[model samples]
Target chain A: MSKGRIIVIDDEDIVLISCQRALAPEGYDVRIVKSGMDGLKMLESEAFDLVLTDLKMPDIDGIEVLRIVKGKWPSVEVIIITGYQTVETAVKAMKLGAFDYIEKPFTPEQILSVVKNAIAHRASE
Target chain B: MKTKVKKTLYSLTGKLILTIGAMMIVGSITFWYFLIYYQERELLKNSVKYSLSFVDYVKKSTRYGMLTFQQLLIQQTVEAIGSAEGIMRVRIFDSKGKVAYSSKKEEIGTILGKNDPLCRSCHSESVKPRDMQSWSIRRDPEGYRILNIVQPIYNEPACYTSYCHVHPKEQRVLGLVESDVSLSLLDKAMKRQKIAITAFVFGFICLISVVLCTILWNLVSTPVSILTQGMERVAAGELDYTVRIDTRDEMGELARAFNAMTADLSKAKKELIEWGNTLEKKVEEKTEAIRKAHEQLIHSEKLASLGRMAAGVAHEINSPLTGIVTFGHLLLKKFPEGSQEREDIEVIIEQANRCSSIIKGLLGFARATSAEKSSANINDILNSSLNMVRHKADFFNIKIVLNLDESLPSIRADASQIQQVFLNMIINAADAMDGKGTLTLSTRKVVENGNPFAEIEFNDTGHGVSEENIPKLFEPFFTTKPVGKGTGLGLAVSHGIIQDHGGKIFVKSTLGEGTSFFVRLPFYEEKA
Candidate 1:
């Protein structure tokens, strides 16, 4: 069986493709969406264990998507992926029940390690 | 403040009155005096003519009486003449100065002396009375005035042939006859004339005063007063004031000229003020432009320097640091789990990552951290920064002193940016002291030119910078540290951050003494 179900949301196709390539071979079920609205639809239609969303996007931002997910499904954990390295937004996301946040330009190993940790945290809960 | 006007000794009107009154008094006195003198002289001449004729009549009428030596007939003739109107007394004296007959019967037997004034007029021809030239005036016992006329009796041929022992023919005079005439009528007329002259003089002086006052008030005094008031207003800076003297005299001309001069002065002052305002605005604009250009030049120069440093770091150090970390991570993947070799590679990777992050931090310094400003307390920022550096200070055996003013006002600043600046300053101070001295951090409120600012100071007992090097301290990439110890962008970046926050950062140092770095930020007030 796959390690756990996860969805990656981003406006950049490259970011979505990179997340899929990095987490698929690491023994996790990875789904990719080009917008926060698509990510939320996918979460609604399927059983997703984790969500990774970009902060700035064309359709609903990661913060609002994270709020909607946490309000609906308390079991699923959410992680923010952003290009801005500002601490205030990260702290705000943490306060809003996000699992973790990672800055952009991450390596494949870095994405696998974060996905592994997020799934492990979900299993423990 | 209004000052009281002093009363001068003589006003213009008073001078006019004084001068006119003086001339009137002198003219009236001279005219009346000459007229009175002429009247007195004419009266005296008329009285003298009448007295001389009466003496000639009495001499002829008494000739027969003297020839007969009839004392009764002579007495009767003298008495009859004396009893006439305006006659006081008549006296006849013999050649021996005896009063032979007189109109006054009681004085008939009186003997007259040669030295008596009535006798001396004929006896002593050398002297005339001081003011009485020929006749002498006397007053009766009842205070009536009498004019005495003296005539000398002559020795004639009939007197020598008379039986009564007459004098010799060589005798030219026999006796003196003194006739006293009453001067009551002349005195009364003189008194009446004097009263008329005195009344005329009084009325003349009164008329002169009225006419002089009227002329002066119309021509000089009132108009001059108005002109003087206008001058006072002008002198008091009321340039719009006008003298309201409407006469056609010199005073009016002077008032008109003064009003014209005030108008000219007012116009000139207004023009000067306008020119001054325009010049001041122009000067302000020029100065502001020059100041803006200067700030822009310095900022652009700093940006250029930062750009160069960023390019160098990103190319050389960044590539190598990233390569080392990547190679160490791949070596970790090949190593067996929990092995000594794998832990060693982890150390290398961790240290390499640290190097990479430091490089990233340097690049961020070049960006000057777009400040997200808020109202922040500088003292609190100092406390947190000190907490971060306190362990490092203790490790170096350096003592830290915090002299913070609790009353320091808040400043509009980015807390994190200011924290970075403070941390850099504290580390620099520790470096300056070489792990052996004291660091003193302080904050205070300072007001400069009515603008309030929060001032933070970091002082260290270390080898201070030389005077020649003080000016170059803020320039990027300028450092006194040995190679690889410092990038030297810390203070320059701090300076840029402070300047962006509308603040100032400067250093004061003296060789062989100590160093102080000061940062001042403008105090914040809530925007409405």
Candidate 2:
């Protein structure tokens, strides 16, 4: 079977690189963007099964992106990534229809497991 | 205003002297009146008796002459005695009521009336006398007093049967003799005596009054005045004043008693003043002690609040530490067992452990662990905490310089807490510099309030806090750092720790230049 398609959005380049490195090896197709604005442009052109986004961003935070994606494609599941300071924001994003939340500097396994669980949940739906 | 007691004329001594003088005057006056009256009466009696005796002698001498009818001899004898010193006149009246013989030649043949002054004594309408000897005292119109005496001669057998008067024996012949006495000399003598007695009495009353006045002054007025003056002084609040009366009477005893009472009052006043001074000093001392205790209580409350804040910040830091540790383990799992990558990951793991230990220390504080103290060198504690952050400072391009004094004494303190304070200050300094400056840590000996202290200074070449923000730097949750960069509890916690160890932390800074933090801890003095 083909792996899931994923889009990662973050202001920190390191976090975007780490998420890309951890999620790509499972045969999933993942694209990385440096901002929530760029991530939304990518979602407009291509359909994505899951989106991983940082809650705090320079232009358009993750929650706004989640709101737009849910309004257009209710089928796509979004996972929230947050720093220790923005944990409360990550929770708020979850209540607003995000799939799950993971703290930043997360282990590779932690991110992969949550991403897998979100894809399976989407397929079941 | 002082009030004066009114003086009275009826004082005790005045009344006494007045009464005595009045009685002496009355007594002396009565004695003088009676003495003059008795003398006058006695003189009058003696004069009257002598005149009567002379008249009788004349009568007897004339009896013989009358027997021979010698009227000239009778006249001579009467005239002789009548012209004597006190006698004014002499007369004889015959049976026919004629003045037969008279010492005054003008009255030799005057007929004597039954109502004449001399005869009226013997012959009045109340009693017609047959034979009577009478006398009278009268004042004539010329203002002279006179005494008149009358003696009646009765018929005798020898007279009737005399050879010259041979008539029937049935006829009776009678005559009278009278005398007058001048009293002007006696009146002059009595008047002179009255003047002498009056003068003597007046002089005596004057002398007695002077003597009585002197006695009153010596005995009553002088002593009473002294007592009155003393009382006035005492009433005017001159309690130290005394009266002096040298008399051996009740007044002298009263003066001595008043003096003793004044002395006692003075002594009691002195003792009360001394007691009041001592009480004031004790009250001042107690006030100072209570003020110090109150300050200590306020510091303890500050520490307790900081402790609670430190607990919350610890939890915040723990979350990030967890992230760092988990990712480091994951990275190690992806590397070979002995690879350089794993070795680098170990460094990350080791720093994360350091972070956890700091959080653990704060948790311990939240648990209200009693502070454990030991003799500790402040310089050593500073160096150890400094080593923990040395690598972090190196990565931030911050340099630390030390100027510790080797001779500084150790203090009784909790080493971990002291180290924590030093570490926080160093990190805060590095942060203020924005990762590029120098931090200087120094320790030396100093004194405050007669107590030896180990003084530590952390001077940072960093952009100091603004004047408005400096005062708030030590307050919990006060920060200039962005969110997630700090919880703003570092300096607050550090201040609590230092104060807990009986030390003080103070900051002085200049804007855009630097900040210097000074910590002073009292040195432990061993009991001798």
Candidate 3:
């Protein structure tokens, strides 16, 4: 069976590239965008089982992307990523239908665990 | 102007001179009157006595001339008689009062009859001429005169001769002897007495005037002049001079009083100068204290603002660090067997670990962590503080909403301090609502008084603070919260922090509506 399709959005090229490289070998299809607008466009044209987005971005924010994903693709699991970890942002992302939140400089085990859990939840649903 | 007037009015010399001059004038007048009156009375009495003695002398000389008339029959003898002492003129008249023989030859043989008033009164038959020893005559131009006795002359009575008995029955009156004396001598003597008395009185008045002037000068003028010199020195700002006057009179008392007053004034002036200096020093000290307080307030504010921004900086660094950590772990999981990729993954993992440590350092900076501070976000601070009492809020059906601004700047601050502030605010809001209300936390960028800053707001939809309590809200230990739930240092500390950053914190509330607190801090511009 085909692994889940995942889209990763980050303002920093290094973070975006790293997320792509880390998840590619995990039996999943991954796409990366450096800007929020590009991520939204990719979400509209293509299909994604899960969207991982950085919380702070220019021209649009991760919270807006999460909001749109939940409204348009309700089944898709949304994870918020942030370099600056804040309880307010985490709570805000969760209220806007984000599946989970991940802080920057997170261990590979932590990211994979959250992603895998979201995928499992989607599959069960 | 007032000082000059006072100086002139209180002058001692003026009063002393005036008193002495008045006394001198009165004394000189009294002396002049007494001297003139007494001298005039004495001279008048002496003149009268001298005139009486001169009249007695003239009377005695007239009697001598009468006795000498018996020798006046010879011409040489009469001429000698005419030169007798004090007898200016002498004549003998017959019984009919005619001049028979005269010492003055011009009046010789002239008839002196009863037609003359003196002769008529003296020889009247009704008058006892023999018993009347003398008579004085007074008439204008003739002046005054005294007449002596007229003797009866007869041949010597022969006691046994018949012719002598016959001559006794036929006795004849000899010519009256007369003497004339000029009154000009007595008048000259009286005039000389009047001149002497007048000179004595004038000289005495002059002496009295000189003495009075001298006394006034010594008693009044000299002391007054000394006082005037002392006053001049005082006017020139010299306060050390002492006025010395040695009299025990009024002027002396006045000098003593003046010196006492000068001493008092000098002391007062010294006190005033010292007071002025002390006042200036006190003002300077107060100014310096105020300046130091202001500087301390600014320093504290900077620290508080840095604390707030610390949250944002921690988050920024944490994001990148999370990514590196994730990527490094991913490489480790995929390349467990030894390979170039595994070595690269190891290096990446090491650097990622280093980056995590750097982020931790950044967190330390953000939280002001070296001194009991730790990195904390606004949301975390709010949540942790609320979580401590989250069960209470929930039990009371209170809903907490944190609308933290996404672009909130990172600040370096003490975490426990901020947490304490948040906890107090939440508790207050919850209590204000009677544990059933909406508690909203909001933050935004704000500029206050032309200074850019960040503003965090804590709003509660509850019974709000009254107008009276708003001004006192930030005062230490001032609280509307129930006694056990609030220490009242929350808002005060927050206010102190904001003030330290050169910012302000304020509150607005409406009765039965809500209360909102806004804390502003100076903006931190990132260095290039």
Candidate 4:
């Protein structure tokens, strides 16, 4: 069975592609969106167990998305992916009910473990 | 003569002496004149009385001869009396005013006319015979003063009743006896007395003037001269001078008062000099302090600008590094486990991670500070700092010697900030050694000016900075590293971090030898 359903939001194509490639091999469903607004739009139509969002983006920021997702879909978990500069704000997102925060330039193993932990958290809840 | 007298009059003492001398001279002149006049009057009266008494004696002695008509005996008596001492001559005039007898034989029969000076008073019609007994002063032929007395021989009842020579009562005056007394001796005595008294008075006045002048000079002029000399010295800026006056008078009191005033003035001058010196020192100290503060302000401004630039650059670089990292890992997973491509991908991932960490450091510099404070072990922070750069140090073939004090107390600090400072120092040391040297890290408790501090020293045995470059070592953008090897912000940011923690960072460098950087932080005591 699939580990969990996750939506990845990022402005960079390589981040989206890397997330898909890293998650697909582990037997999980992953969707990619380019911006926070697009990720929220996708979340309205689809039921996701976890949300992975970039803390910095052009259309909207990750903190607002984390707040909106946590408010609208109470069951979904958020994991904020932050670049080096936005790590402090990323931690703030965690306090705002994000499941966890991850610093940028993360390894494939690092991303997979965090996603897995987030899914397990949803299951436990 | 006029100028000499006027000169004497102008001078005080001379004027006084001259005035006294002048008074003495005038008084002597007046007294001499009165003395001569009075003595001459007395001498004239005494001479008149002697002449009258001698005339009476001649008349009495010649009375028996005259009653016997003995004219020769009477003449002999007159001659005898006139030859006495101080008697110039004697004459007897008959009733017709002819000289009946004379002491000088040439005047024995000389006739006296009514208009003659001797007979003018006694024989004049306006004169009564009883009022004619008078005297007069005359100068004789030899210029000798003489007193002449004229006495009318009066006939009384006995003369009229005499048997030899009887006269009627109506013809009571018989003849006149004239006696001329010499006055030269009296005049000579008065002249001698006048000369003696005048000489004595003048000498006395001169002596008194000399004595008075000497006394006045000692009492007033000497003291005044000393005081004037003292005043001149003081006016010439010699405040230390004092006047010496031995007299216990007003001048002495004045001298004492002046000495007191000069002493006070000297003291005030000394105090003013001291105050001026102190003011100059204070101004110099204040100027030095201001210069130090100005340098600090400029350093702070430079750091603030650099921090802002670092933040913007960090934000721009971090996103791209993330993308690069993510793609590199994805590519690594695509390759087989033993492939060279996987290894290349690992290298790319490693480089990207390095870039990210650098960006994280830049972010740290940007944020400048976090409000969070916690008690952290300095030894632990030091170890972490070494671990972060251990691989780089190994790659550079550099050796690091640690001399941490194990018993160092924990301090209140932000671990991450302290860690950044350490890391920067380590990296700089590696750079300074040019990838081949030893770095000695030492930690100890230090006391500076009675304040306890934790000292961390980083000694590097690398090509040391020159003396000229040592001062600029901590300045922003000042780097000795090659173009691509250093950003030049490492030491500046490190210095800022240490300063923010209320610590000091300093360096000691010697050319061609090595450099040591020291960081001193105040010890944090737990609050009760």
Best by lDDT: 4
Compare the candidates by TM-score and give the number of the best one: 4
- lDDT tens digits, residue span B1-528, model 1: 122212321777777678878888988989889988999889978987898778778878988888888889999999999999998788887767788888999997777776876666645767552223257777777676778887777677888778886677788777767788988888788879988998998898888789888998778888878888888888898988887877677988998888899999999989999999999999999999999889867775866576557745643554344345545655677889999999999888766665655555566565564788988889899999888878753435888888999988777889988998999898888888788788898888888779988889999998999999997787776788775566677887788788879888989998778899999999878786
* Cα lDDT listed for each candidate: 0.80, 0.78, 0.67, 0.81
Superposed by TM-score, candidate 2 places the C-alpha of residue B30 at a distance from the truth, in angstroms, of 3.5
Q: What TM-score would chain A of each candidate receive against the reference chain A?
A: 0.95, 0.96, 0.94, 0.97
Q: Which pairs in model 2 have colliding backbones?
A: B149-B178, B149-B179
Candidate 2 residue-wise lDDT, B334-451, digit = tens:
8999999999998888767666655654554453334588889888898899889887734358777889999887789888878877887887888788888888888988989898
TM-score of every candidate relative to the true structure = 0.47, 0.45, 0.49, 0.61
Interface RMSD per candidate: 7.1, 6.1, 3.3, 2.1
**For residue B224, what is the lDDT in candidate 2?**
77
Predicted complexes: DockQ each: 0.03, 0.07, 0.34, 0.48
Q: Residue B224 deviation, candidate 2, in Å?
A: 2.8
Tens-place lDDT digits, model 4, residues A1-125: 77889999998887788788778888999999999989998999999999999888898899999999999998899999876667678778879999998876777789989999989989999
* Decreasing lDDT order of the candidates: 4, 1, 2, 3
User: Predictions ranked by TM-score, top down?
Assistant: 4, 3, 1, 2
Where's the lowest-lDDT run of ten residues in candidate 2 chain B?
B1-10
Better of 2 and 4 by TM-score: 4
Which residues of candidate 1, in runs, are more than 4 Å off? Answer: A1-125, B1-9, B30-34, B64-73, B115-117, B120-133, B141-144, B156-165, B304-312, B315-318, B321-528
Two-chain complex of model 2, DockQ on C-alpha atoms against the true structure: 0.07
Ranking the candidates on DockQ from highest down gives 4, 3, 2, 1
